[model samples]
Target: MGAGVDYIFIGDDFTGASDTLATLARAGRRVRLFLDPPDAAAIAEEGLDAVGLATEFRALPAEAIAVQMDVLAPLLKALSPRIVHYKVCSTFDSSPETGSIGAAVAVLERHLDPALVAVMGGQPSLERYCAFGNLFASGPDGQIHRIDRHPVMRNHPITPMAEADLRIHLARQGLQDLLLLAWPEIEERRATLKTHVDELMRAGKKRMLFDACDQGHLETIGAALGGCGSDGRPLLIVGASSVAEALSGDLRPPGVAAPAQGSRTEGLCLVLAGSRSQVTAAQVKAARRFKPMPIQPRHLADKTAAGAFAASCAAALAAGENVLAHLAPTEDYRCSGAELSCKLANLVAAILDRQTVCALGVAGGDTSSIIVRRLGFRSLAFEEQLDAGVAICVAASDMPQRDGMRLMLKGGQVGSDAVFDRFVSAMNTKSPTTPSGLWRHHP
Candidate 1:
């Protein structure tokens, strides 16, 4: 906290946070992500090059996001990193009512008082691109589509992406007046790009968006960003893990850097899917190794019903069968996503209370955040990359039973059809000793 750390990122959810963690750690940078804000002593003790605070704000109302940021502002200020990165989902999933990225930007800008607000608009490594202020992503069907029209995102149960233009989308959330530097501008000479940025800054631009058509664009954008605030003021950046990818640029040469797989253990592997995304539904269906046990929506509202369901999952695990507890895809929930996620977390907690889970997998960002918090994990170290946007993590937890438990978290839209099957196999693959994954801490 004495200013050695160059960057501090506040991730909107656990999955995105770990993606950023992977980007930095794989870059050979010493990084650690905490479940909550750690004290300066902890920061100093970790000898971190970058620190992160993983949050569940992406599932909250705008007012709630503001409240959370108010609590975090002081801790962020204490770290005093050269850059304060506010990491949002790569797909830029949000709405005016919930997970408002614009609202978050406004709050952080006022509190952190950075020289400028720069939003990195693409994560090309994941094949996500931003051109002319529109966001596009590769779909499971092997075609790129505007995020609003993408098969999974268009019909997202919550925060359905109705618009592909980020400027239009964010304006609805009160973040208008953002200046844009298109892909062509990004591809121009570095000095020319700087001149454009300077002109905008001189004209009183506080927030600016840059287009990154590919990984090269992200690096060029990152190289330009790396030179930001050399005048000694901290730069406030916003985006997904690509922000880290951009910042680490040429400093750390890129490589495959696959995450380390944990040594297999002997207990049952449990999977919980609280997401209703088509991607998740397919993963659940294809995960043949696990006995599927779908929870009805009505049962989520009734504790007795939920308990009975948990009992069944516990029974299956005890019989040496890996169980998949998921919300019925066709069932309509009478509760909010947050509420239903809480119910799912409660069920998972109950299962942990009754069974010995050697490995666990949780799908859905909000669900993973709530379940991990309920399980009392204070920190997570990247263990392996189960899929794009999914990281198998080693839990550094306060709960003795859960300490060092191998867990995997996947965003609803992330992973493939066979993702769940692969997760189970990864957990089942035995190794002689704990793999030399990235180092992590609980305190």
Candidate 2:
């Protein structure tokens, strides 16, 4: 119900709403985000007169789509947003259900004028927009600009032509000057990113901006930049969720250290796992011997512990430590998508304010796209479709104050051992780090 609010972000998860709100807020817009399903209690808690649905359509089965529409239709009529922005995923192709767009549009059409609706996808698909010219440019403010202009704004899955017309609508909004930070791809991504930085600096924009395509992107950016914050110290934040999963058998590796406790203290890793089933004395023994290095772990299965862990990771990142966060799915744990996303966005905003570089993330299940787009990278095209496996994404702001972060979503069936090794190896090899850092030994 607040006045002068220009944007209302709705997502199935909190991170998307939070990220979009943060970006728009930084740009001096009055934004309110609704991260959960619209209900009387949630509406009262957020004190908003408007709402946006941020859920990804593909996450639901085709049979459920109609049911979802039945629920959303009334909600749209009740909230009556000036513009209903439906967030889409360029990488999602599960279930052959035509995904979230069609489902969202179907519901919105029942209550609002179709002219008031807009559809947007995150960073992974930035190239899909024809407006991307140099991939690298500098703004007059001495800031690097990765401009994006897409041709599709309102295309439904059922109607392909709506996408083209949507582009015309975007052009009218004066979004042509909108600049985005580009992620490094192949050798050229980094080079292109670096070139844009140089151009921005030459134009008098010397502040390093961060935006990651995934956690790998964050690690890659962190590694390339030598893991130093603006104050010139090594980034030492922990990836609590990943660490937690490791302790819980969700991330078990063959050589992983067993948990250990001294006479006066219990194993920190065991305590973090917080699962009576997963965190046993034997598991603790195994955790103590894990190679590489050990991070402080948290109990993600426990809602209270997970919230605390998320908060702590955010705090560390805000303090300029390189942090990784892991999230278990709703099915595996009690955490909700909206709650997790809100916590992440809050932490990212805090880090940005400190000007300390850090990464924010979520892992496990279908959480990657929701979290990554929340941070504002337009989605990119994936080489292969994800098939009941892990989905990892990283989102970073171009500004050095905000550390680039990753969201790694692994599936239940993926072996924890292989996942951890591959994750660490990938991060170490791709991330730029000092000679004395963990990544230094990586081949």
CA lDDT, candidate 1, residue 227: 69
Candidate 2's residue-wise lDDT over 163-192, tens digit each? 222223233322222233444341256534
| Candidate 2, RMSD to the unseen true structure | 19.5
For model 1, the superposed segments whose C-alpha errors exceed 4 Å read 1-4, 190-203, 250-266, 430-443
Looking at candidate 1, what is the lDDT of residue 163?
91
Among the numbered candidates, top lDDT falls to 1
lDDT of 1 by residue, 1-443 (tens): 36456888898998788778766766656677789888777767666768889999898899999888999887877766788899999898899889998888888878778888887787887778999999998887879999999987887777888898888888898878778889887887555666667677878997888888888787777777776766656788889888988887542233233334445565678999988877788898888899999888756888888788888899999898999988877888888888888888888999889897978899989898899888888887665556677767677887788887888788887787888888777777664223222443212
Error of 2 at 161 (Å): 18
For each candidate, the alpha-carbon lDDT, in order, equals 0.79, 0.32
TM-score of 2: 0.33
Q: Estimate each model's TM-score.
A: 0.91, 0.33
Q: In TM-score terms, which candidate is top?
A: 1
